[model samples]
Target: MQGLMQDWPLTVDKILDHAKAWHGGREIVSRSVEGPIVRTTYAEIHERAKRVSNALLGLGILPGDRVATLAWNTGRHIEAWYGIMGMGAVCHTLNPRLFAEQLVYIINHADDRIIITDLTFVPVLASIRDQIPGVKHIIVLSDEAHLDGSLPGALAYETLVENASADISWGGFDENTAAGLCYTSGTTGNPKGVLYSHRSNFLHTLVTMGSDVLGIKATDTVLPVVPMFHANAWGLTFSAPAVGAKLVMPGPKLDGASVHELLETEGVTFSAAVPTVWQMLLTHLRTSKGTLSTLKRVVIGGSAVPEAIVRGFRDEYGVDVTHAWGMTETSPLGTQATPNYAISQMDAEQQLQFKLKQGRAPLGIELKLVDDDDKPLPHDGTTFGRLKVAGPFVVGEYFRAEGGKILDQDGFFDTGDVATLDEHGVMQITDRAKDVIKSGGEWISSIEIENIAAGHPKAELAAVIGVVHPKWDERPLLLVKLKTGEAATKDEFLQFLDGKIAKWWMPDDVVFVDEIPLGATGKIDKKLIRERMKDYVLPPAAGVASGAVALAAPPEPKIYAPEPEPEPVVEPGHEDDAWLHWTPDAAQSVDRSRREAPAAPADHVEAPADAQLPFRGR
Candidate 1:
């Protein structure tokens, strides 16, 4: 017999409603695209959001219709989000960083009806207006006076909402109704939408609030430097209000100076963003000797965090750094590196080693590693396998079934990541399955090499890609974007890694480039890199790595070879792509006789600028 429990649906609107009633004075400070900071309380946001719903309804928006938002993180943008989702409409967040063609494709594919965007993106929407005929209204998130007449027939978001009435009801539908749509960065072939249900999003919000998860508290002041379009700002939009935490939304400038200014002036206690933003911030801090006096904690994601970053934040700034790992498909918060009780008791340095790995699954999620043939693999910490995730918040299938039947019979979704989970349940991502370099029947982790190379003092940003080799099938190629005004020879870098990594894992060449372009999600554009370096060929196996200049003709390939081992059991995984279509080089015949030489163990945006809107609790 079923127990008697309240049948209250877990709609997202309840989070806002509860915030309005209990924490009505909680602030949502925003750096506006127009200059000044806009401060609005949860109570005001609640009322204005209701007005947004009425305005959308008057414009022919119905429940289940798709309303797209292409704007930066701000109070108005959040209002638009709640306004759209509160009325049972799907809020589709469009990444402005994406190409115009991609925007066209996504808007057309999702059949987005209304485009609510910031003034910054008005030109972008205007350029693609003809391509996306499905978008009926262009609601500019600004006052009516700010209209420059660039985009004809555009509605001012402020005036539209101000003219509407808030006497309307919300949430009379099922909790499982679709609430938000976020497309993947499309690192592979095409961007696929991950449709989230109100039930799943609500449950995910609750999961993120756990002590071992985001650990966001009502007393915390949050600065979500990660864009709102990025996996719903990693689900902070809902959880902040759910827990009554104050939010600070950075407008459009994500440069180092602006972010540092906001962190200092606004008294931000906690913040989250990708590694690139932190790098820029750390650079600015080092140059200017800036400080994050009020900032206590930080969440780093989007890509692997460099060792220098963790050290810079924790060692220099006296801040806590938590490495987060997740994908759009998992409501964006699969696992965070927050140490559990057992690991947390250790000293700071000792705990950092554990913190570097993606922490164990939270209460609701389960993680497992599997080999080829879908067989279970051991969690021995050293062995790498395809990572699979099973959780309530993870996506069951992509929208429109672009990649059909992704989930296994047991209901686990393949994360396309190669990882190692230790006996203590700590998960460390080694590389993408498709990006792993296969040489002589064995796999080499480019991420491992890239991380080591990035630790160099002169190195700023680093990437490792496999290139065709005559004997070993595929060998690694190192690409470095050196820190400004810093220079180092190829010999210094290779010598730095001589004792720290396996000799066989060393790159065949090191190309120093002026810049490394980040993808829409701030990840290394490996696809673009491969395209740019497609014509580059590896030097002879016996010679030293080919740097920008030869530097010197070092010793031949006399590195010691380890004992021959059997090949790892791995299958060809989902396409490893970023931004553009890339054809991976096929593995050649393995020369099993040659073993890899092992060596000693080694160590190791779109937010606003001055756009730093500070926040304080009432």
Candidate 2:
């Protein structure tokens, strides 16, 4: 017999509808683009979204039409997110951080018909507006005050909503229809769009709510330091309201002091951002000698969170940091490091190490470590392999690409991450497979080396990239970006790294730079680093063909060693089934629902908003 709960169609509108029906009173506060905390309830958001949806339909936006949003994280931006998706039109969030030419490419590539932007970004849009031919309407999310009768063909955000009715109908959308599009920051090449379906988005929010994961609740005032243009602000925009959590958006003020003031004043309970943002926040808090008490949990992803950061937040402020792993294709939330009971029993240092890992897959995700040949490896945590996953929330293909087959034979998305899974099923990403440095035929994790380097008292941030080495094939070159006014000599920094990591793993040399370049998504742009320093000389190979810089052949025919097959086990029922794909074991049943449960830890404490602490909840 089949279960009563058959497959029910899901859409972003339904997510908003539920918020309005049940948690309508919940607040969504934002530091408006114009400067001020603009607050509104979920009920208001639902109505406005409806109005916006009606307005889009009036604009002749058809199903699957791409409505672009070039705005910051604000109330109006959130409205545009739901408004476009609710109408069955795809909401393509354009990352303003990307270069102008790339922005033009994305807008034209996606064939954006209409664009909704903020007052601050008008100049940027104006500069590139003529380049994108398909854009028909440009709606500015502001009032007439900012309008100089300039910007031809641009409409005001209020004008459209004011004329449109809020009683529009929904329930016409199929869950498979595209709901949103987010491009990967093109550090290596042109940015590619990861088209997200309504079902994938809805399920991602559910997984986001897991107590040990993003764990958001109605009473919490959440802030996404990550930009809305980047992976839906890591899905916090939708996930926040899905659970009725008030979203506190930091508009243009993302500087240390500004973010600090907002977090303290707004009583933000939970926050999410990349490591770069946290490093700045931590530096500000330390310099200011501020105290954070009410802050309960923080989700740190995008790049690996340095061990120092994990230690600082937990030991100094008591804020639990959950490390997550995902990509634009995964609705941005995949594995989460929720320190299970076994790891929690370890000492503070050991626990911190565990917390530094990518953690286990959320409920809906199926994670596996695969060898170069696509054969699965063990969950022993020692075997490093490429990571692949599939779930309800993970994207299967790119937007409108021909023959767009993105998944493997059995349907798992290769995440391009090289990682290991512990016996507890926790996955720790050592580095990107492409970034792993092979020295003397053995792989060295640049991420590990960099994380250790970040622990140096003088180093503010560190990036390790594999540079050319004649003998070793590839050797690590450490690029150190010191904090403002901080100083550390090369000898001192090298000494600090000396007993912390393996001798073979130590960087051959250290180079200090004014600053590290950041890609569009705010992550370190390693590709640019390599390109910038490509001319550096390398030491001779030990035993390879010549002493000169000898490059290892790219993973080809004779590169990877095969794993021994598992002995055949006599099953109680049938042992006649021949083993198919060589995995450590049969694919663990993939469940698409784990991505939906709230994964925040229960220990999150909330205090009154007016508390004097730097990290208190309102």
lDDT of 1 by residue, 1-618 (tens): 998999999999999999999999999998898979889999999999999999999999999999999888899998999999999999999877666677888999999999999888787788779999988999999998999999999999989998999988989899999999988767677889889999999999999898788899999999998877888888899999998999998887677888888888778998988877888899899999787899999888877787778988888999998887888888878788878778878898888887767777887788989998888899898888999989888899989898899999899999888889987788888888878899887888888788778889898878899988888899988877676566666667788779877998878777665455556676766765665566778877544544441111011111111123244322244122121222222111212112321111000122311110010000
In model 1, what lDDT does residue 190 have? 80
**Per-residue lDDT for 332 in model 1?**
79
**RMSD list, candidates in order:** 11.6, 15.9
lDDT of 1 at 558: 15
Kindly report which residue stretches of model 1 are placed more than 4 angstroms away from their true locations once superposed. Answer: 541-618
What digit string (tens of lDDT, one per residue) describes model 2 on residues 128-193? 777988999999998767776567878989888889999988658689899999876654456778
**Candidate 2 wrongly placed segments (more than 4 Å):** 4-7, 402-404, 538-618
Looking at model 2, residue 324 earns an lDDT score of 80
Give the per-residue Cα lDDT of candidate 2 at 111.
Answer: 93
For each candidate, the alpha-carbon lDDT, in order, equals 0.78, 0.73
TM-score of decoy 1: 0.88
